[model samples]
Target: MVSVLTKIFGLTNIEIAEDIVHDVLLKALESWKLKGVPENPSAWLMAAAKNKTLDFLRHKKQEEKYARQITPLLQSEYTIGHTLNNYFSENEIKDDQLRMMFVCCHDSINEESQIALILKTLCGFSVSEIAKAFLTNDSTINKRLYRAKEKLRELEIKFEIPVPSEIEKRIDQVLKALYLLFNEGYSSTEGESFIREELAAEALRLCLILSQHTAGNIPKTLALLALMYFHGARFNARIDDEGNILLLKEQNRKLWDNEMIQEGIILLNMASTGDLVSTYHIEAAIAYEHCIAKSYNDTNWKNLLNYYQVLITLTKSPVAELNSAIVISEIDGPDAALNVIFKIELADELKNYYLLPATKGDLYFRKSDMIKAKYFYDIAETLTSSPFEKKLLRKKSNMCT
Candidate 1:
């Protein structure tokens, strides 16, 4: 609704569009209490918005730009109803939202602010919720959003889809934001729940929209979606009824969503057709290998190691190198993996990363060096803030006794 209204209002009055939507919702809350909710609630809301728009036009001051812009469309009741109906339709809503996402991810805005704006506007996320997702304070998120909105206003960016020539560059920003959102859901940094499936679900929903559009249904997008689906397939088994984290080795494969895994495979196959082999393609292939493995011991460690090598070459990310070492532990033994681990820690950015310590703990435990295992786990316990992770580290540390 905000997207549609912003489209009609010419981007200058986004705040006003949001205000009108709020007023409409408030009216619904007040009236529905006495009227006991209308049967055609959607139609009622559209009608209300239409009437509210007309009312604003009628009482507008001389310099109201939106009033002037929409006045020509409100010459009669029929035109007003038609225009509102057109905007309120399902297809229009989806298109408006897609375009709104592109606008939110405009190059003028920084990546953090772009994701922040997408959460707030397109995903109906509260400022506090977005702050929690980002592991930051509400005031910081608010300031970021304020700056992003001001930038959009200052630039007067169009509220439409990008041209074909610009789609490749523009779409990556959107994909990055969505990937971060899914990762947050898969492993929440600062929440009671280890997995916020709702956030993951929302991200998947938005990605599917991109994967279906002509400008967006490219190989990279398919690979990203495949990665999301492959992870999501195991969501049910990733946590116990008591909300305890279930390591992949311990999760019940019977509980995994086979349908989703199959869909992910189909997407992965589709992704292979294009010339580009993005990091997402490698990640998705690795995830697909895990999804197809019958058990933890049956996993193709060599295949995953190869993908991680490619990933490291492409990204040079310490995180990727750390993960690659884990696969090496499975294939080559703890000593070889530890050598790689030592090399990875030379990078300054990963000095305090808990996973490095945790990986070292696992390798020491595998080598039956309980004292060194406990030592690394102790460091890991201090490095991580997650309650689930702390508990897991304590369990590992206790094994040394």
Candidate 2:
């Protein structure tokens, strides 16, 4: 809704569009509470939004500024309804959303700001939710959003898909933001719940939309979508009835979504058609290894380690190195994994990352070094804000006693 309205209002008047959306939603809440939800709730909302937009445009036709390209059409009565009807059409709304994705990921904005804008405008993430996702405060998120909007306005960023020549580069930026969004949902940093299924689902939905478009139907896009499906397929078995985190070794393979796994496999095969081997391809391969295994012990750790090594080389991410160390432990020994962890520790790249200490604790526990394991578990507990993680770390610490 915001995207469609932004197309009509222009980037400079984004707040106006936002206000209109909020009002429409508030009105829905009130009406629904009194009269019950309409049979076609989605159509109802879209109709309400269209009516509100028309009312706003008609009232401010002569005074308020709108998109320069369509200003004259909006001002004239005969063209106003037709123009709006065209924008509100199903195909145009989808196009507006895709355009909004590109606009949020404009090269002029920094990556962080791009992501913040995407979360707020495109994904319907609240300021507080975005703050929690970023492990920051609402004030900081607000500032990032403010600056991002100002940049969009100053540059007069068009709400249109990039041309063919620039589409790949622009799509890369959007993919990066979506990747982070999915990760946050898959292993959320917020509250007690480790998974925010809705956020991850939203990311996947947007990725699917991108995949349907000619400009975004590239190998990298398909690879990322495949990765998401592989990960999402495990959601049911990732936690216990008590809402505690379940390690892969403890999860029930029977609970996994086989249908989703099949979809991921299909997408992965499609992704492999092109010569470009993105980091997502490697990551998805690693995930696919785990999905195909009958049990944790049956996993092909060597294959996963190879994929992780490739992933680490491509991205040089400390997180990937840490994950690769875990795979090494499965193939080699705890001591081997510890050696890699020690090297990562020396670099101090993951100094404040709770997972670093958490991984160390797990390694020491496997070695039966209770004292060191407990020590690392204690540090890991202190570093993480998630109550679930803290509880799990404490559980490990108690085992040491």
Candidate 3:
């Protein structure tokens, strides 16, 4: 709704579009309280927004001259209804949201600002929510948003999908932004809850939208969706009734969503069409290994290690290396895995990364070095801000006592 309205008002008047949306929502709250939600609530809201926008344009006259472009079409009530009906049509709304996402990823804006803009505009995230997402203050987020909106005005970027030639690069940015959003939800930091399922679901929803488009339904898109589905299948099993974290080995496989797992397998198969192998493809393969395993002990550590090796070759991500070391611990011994961990050159980056110390704690615990395990777990507890993670680390630390 915001996307369609913003397109009509021009990018320069985004706040006006936002204000209209806010007012429409307020009206809905007030009216619904007395009269109850209408049968077709969506259509009702669209009509209300359309009426408010028309009234604003008419009242402002020369002030909002940008609406002058559609003034003739909106001259009569009949014509105005016809024009707005087309704009708010189901197909047009989807296209508008997709285009808006591309505009947020314009090269003129920095990636951080692009993400902030996307969270704000597309995901309907508040500045405070965005600040918490980035582990920064609201003022910092506001500044990023200010700079991003100014960049949009300066560049005059259109609210349209990129050309075919530019689709791959621009879509990569879109994927990255969505991936980060999903990760934040999957392993949320300290917030209202440990897992922000809505944020992750929103990311998955946007990815599905992209996969439906001609330029976006590529191999990489399928792979990313497959990866997401594989992870989402276990969402229910990730937490106990009390919302404590569950280790992979501890999760009940019966609680996993088999339907999502099957869908992920199908998508993973479809993602194999192109010669382009992405980190998503490798990650999906690793997740597939876990999904098919009867038990944690039955997991194909060799295959997982092979996938992680390929992933490291492609991306050289520290997280991948850390995971690869874990796989080594399962196949080889704790000593070998510990040696591999010690040899990892990017120790500086991993120093405060809770996973590293957590992995070390697990490895030491497996080796029956309880004192060392407790020490590493203590460090892991301090490094992590997540209440869920802290609880799990404390559980491990207590085992050493």
Which predicted model would earn the best TM-score? Answer: 2
How close is every model to the real structure, measured as TM-score?
A: 0.92, 0.94, 0.94
Model 2 lDDT per residue over 110-133, tens place: 888987888788776778887777
lDDT score of residue 12 within candidate 3: 77
Candidate 3 structure lDDT: 0.85
Over 4 Å off, model 3: 64-78, 132-136
RMSD of each: 2.5, 1.9, 2.1
CA deviation > 4 Å runs, candidate 2: 67-69, 132-137, 192-195
**Number of backbone-clashing residue pairs for each candidate, in the order shown:** 0, 0, 0
lDDT of each: 0.85, 0.88, 0.85
Whose lDDT is greatest here? 2
Error of 3 at 284 (Å): 1.6
Q: What tens-digit string does per-residue lDDT give for candidate 3 at 264-380? A: 999999999969999899989999999999999999999999999999999877778888999999999899899888878366778679899889999999999999999999999
